[model samples]
Target: MSVDDFKHRGRRKMLVDLLRTKGIEDEKVLEAINLVPRHLFLDSAFIEYAYKDEAFPIAAGQTISHPFTVAFQTQLLDIHPNEKVLEIGTGSGYQTAVLVGLGAEVFTIERQKDLFDFSKIMLKKINFEPRYQTYGDGYKGLPSFAPFDKIIVTAGAPEIPNELLNQLKVGGIMVIPVGEESQQMLVIIKLSENQYEHYEFGNFKFVPMLERRDK
Candidate 1:
């Protein structure tokens, strides 16, 4: 049975409220979070706690990110309508759905075949169509579609990849986490061809960004 009903909406509203209390001030981000049925992105076993601000395991040993983490990173991006967004890790595609709801032209990538397939099915089912998605290396952000208005890496990178920086449009922003075990959420703004600005938010834990395609 479809769970995207009244109860789910209520939970989402409460989740948004919690995000607000936790310092997510962006109305657009909150609205997008409210509209997306986060429950639909989890396994049936985790459905009960899907609305809670916690990460839960999905397929391929990956976990869906906490709602707060999603909101925080999204707020940092300062997304504008019709902006082209390169999402490094599609995971459950929950973030991609939120990005599309925020009016971005999203291009997402996922390495795990199971997750790539799952996100494809779920996104199509919900009508959250990103402009493009592929199974590839996140380290080499979509060079063919370079100059993206924004780029978001959903996993924790040990070091910033220069390729992703190159893919970002001049003056564009990229929100990523850098570290091992735990990460510091970093918001990077490409100032010029070789210059960039960065700000580190607090720490967060995400599935480690793996190397190459997981075939």
Candidate 2:
């Protein structure tokens, strides 16, 4: 096969593996992951490996998370078709695109200026740019758009921010990876006033969440 044909087939195979083998069975999320061109989200130098279920470095010493991570994180959000969601880390906009494709009205924030710029452009390129209320500091959830039905933090935090918890509506859910040296991902579900439940899923390493002093 020609080089171009080989790459196309490889991407298709990757998609199948993600759905059938990786346990990403949500039809909506799977379809979105397949529809959004992963190659377009990576640097031209890494485009050939874009479809692989792996992480790749981007600017700002950050990496676009693995595709399985994206699917799992998104699935944990339990998004409703028209729910408003807040994403703390935009990264490469791959996760943002998936959220939008799942029919959630997303309000995403990115602290790193270069990453913010890149994600904005890439999201627009795929016509998947969400409600995009970018901020430099993700520690403070988008309070102005508070009462988000769901909030997802892509970066790992030492602890859940009070502001983020306050932003969630009663009976809402927030998926975050929290830790200092090691990370444990969990889903926090708000039961009602002064009541919340937490479930630990698994352990994973991720870029530490940083506070943007200038934001």
Candidate 3:
């Protein structure tokens, strides 16, 4: 954990202003972004650049999504308080904290062991304890915790995982990025048991979502 003093808070306010200009209109989403201490989510050397609306390198060869991207996806989720939100990649727990701050009951998964471990401790240190944090395959989703109210995948996938789609409750929404390289942000609204509505929100890049290869 790192100190979040006036310096970091001022930077975050500026970042929120930048995000506003970038079209992040959800006040709750913007407030969450402003509240979470992104500087603490990065390595010390890059702390100065933490609130610059840019992605920074983190453990497990992953990059935290830029603040704009995070806010965009979050705004698309249309999260409501107490919603059961499943986060597919807990890189640095930054987004998870944002969700928690938005009053969602978050269940986050991290397939990379290093990140899974680091984030578990980091989140605890800051007291942003999500409802559940698991080290497992994102493609598999969380069966026992099925029927999430909203789901956010933090990585780029070659295609949307049907397994995850199965875990969503009817009338829920899922915001994911799908592509081989740069991904188009997709919003999947579960209409019924077998019905869904899909929409795209332009292209963005993210760390590729990884799966566990069975032997």
Candidate 4:
């Protein structure tokens, strides 16, 4: 069979397996996973593995997040239909596209120019373009698009970014991975005007969150 055909079949089956076993309970998120063409976001060589619940290398030393991770994080956000979202590290635009499919007005940032450009093209190709902008420094988040209703960081940071926390609107949620070495924790931070509530779900590992590589 053709590579494209294989990818389509393989990814569909993988999505089914993920929902069946990964404890991913949200129907809307599952449908988005089923509907989004994950293979298109990956390089042709790795397209066959697109649907498996695993991260794959993308350009600029970044990796596309696993499908379960994407679904789990999206579920944590509890995003409303009209909510605005800020995504840090738009590696392959896969995660961004998922959020868009969930009806979010997304704003994303990537520090790697190559990945940023590639994701921009892919976003346009998939019609997943965010509302306000995409940037090269994810650490800074999007101050211009401040007060986002939800924020999801796809990479691992040593600690949660204070700037990103500040940008979330009251009652907004930010899902991120925090760690230093091998293991990272998926943390959900719910913002309030005066206080924040945090919940750490489980362990994970991701590409390190970067500042400006140029600098």
Model 4 global lDDT (CA atoms, 0 to 1): 0.79
User: Which ranges in model 1 have alpha carbons more than 4 Å from their true place?
Assistant: 213-215
lDDT by residue (59-89, candidate 1, tens digit) is 9999899999999999999988999999999
lDDT values, one for every candidate: 0.92, 0.84, 0.92, 0.79
Q: Which 10-residue span in candidate 4 carries the lowest summed lDDT?
A: 1-10
For model 1, give the RMSD to the true fold: 1.1
- Please write out the lDDT profile of model 2 over residues 50-147, one tens digit for every residue: 77878999888998988888888888888779899999999878899889988899999999888898889878866898986585789987888899
Question: Candidate 3 residues 1-215, lDDT tens each?
Answer: 45999999999999999999999999999999988999888988898899897898898899988999999999999999999999999998999999999999999998888888888998999888899999888898888998899999999999999998999999999999999879999999999988999999999998898855631
- lDDT string, candidate 4, 89-137, tens digits: 8887888888888888888887877888888887787687767556568
Off by over 4 Å in 4: 1-10, 212-215
- As a TM-score, model 2 comes out at 0.92
Two-way lDDT contest, 1 vs 2, winner = 1
Q: Which ten residues in a row have the lowest lDDT in candidate 2?
A: 1-10
Ten contiguous residues with the weakest lDDT in model 3: 206-215
